[model samples]
Target: TQLLEQSPQFLSIQEGENLTVYCNSSSVFSSLQWYRQEPGEGPVLLVTVVTGGEVKKLKRLTFQFGDARKDSSLHITAAQPGDTGLYLCAGARDKLVFGAGTILRVKS
Candidate 1:
């Protein structure tokens, strides 16, 4: 099985909606990095929660790492079209193991 699995795969929302994406795994990682990507562009680091149970917030988004370092989550509040992008959760050790990803679309 894949090390990481993200749910929904895709999400669509209006200008002012809330959404959450999940990342689950059976294996533990040293660290987890959440990235957001635009078309034809490299993934940009949104946050890296190293310590388990760590919670970091960026604008309308919140990220959390599981206590066992085996999973993570991303929550977005009051979404806007500007929030539209592909959200990817990747677990890393010597290398990164990525989830399929959750593509979010926020329409005005």
Candidate 2:
């Protein structure tokens, strides 16, 4: 079975701080997506990277896909308290494989 591994399993920071999270896999994927989930809520898709080396940004958040399609990263700039949540990465091939997830807590 393929698996996605996320680094820094948990993160805590004061508001306006910056942080970065990573997701990696040994298996190649046709596409990869990032999502964020709050307590008691389903994950909300943040971005999808299909082409190798692709990068996308939403507000203060940035998403990147590795050139080999086996890794990805998410960077948050000046993180705010509202950014606290569980971040997940999913790889799509024959099926979607999800990472363990990174729990982020931003204090105000």
TM-score for each model: 0.96, 0.97
Mark the regions of model 2 whose C-alpha exceeds 4 Å error after superposition.
none
lDDT of 2: 0.95
Q: Which candidate is the best by lDDT?
A: 2
How many residue pairs clash in all the candidates, one count each? 0, 0
The collision pairs in model 1 are: none
Q: List the residue pairs that clash in candidate 2.
A: none
Please give, for residues 1-108, the per-residue lDDT of candidate 1 as tens digits.
667999989998898889999999989899999999999999999999999999999988999999999999999999988899999999998899899889999999
Best of the candidates, TM-score: 2
Cα-lDDT of candidate 1: 0.93
Please list the C-alpha lDDT of all candidates, in the order they appear: 0.93, 0.95
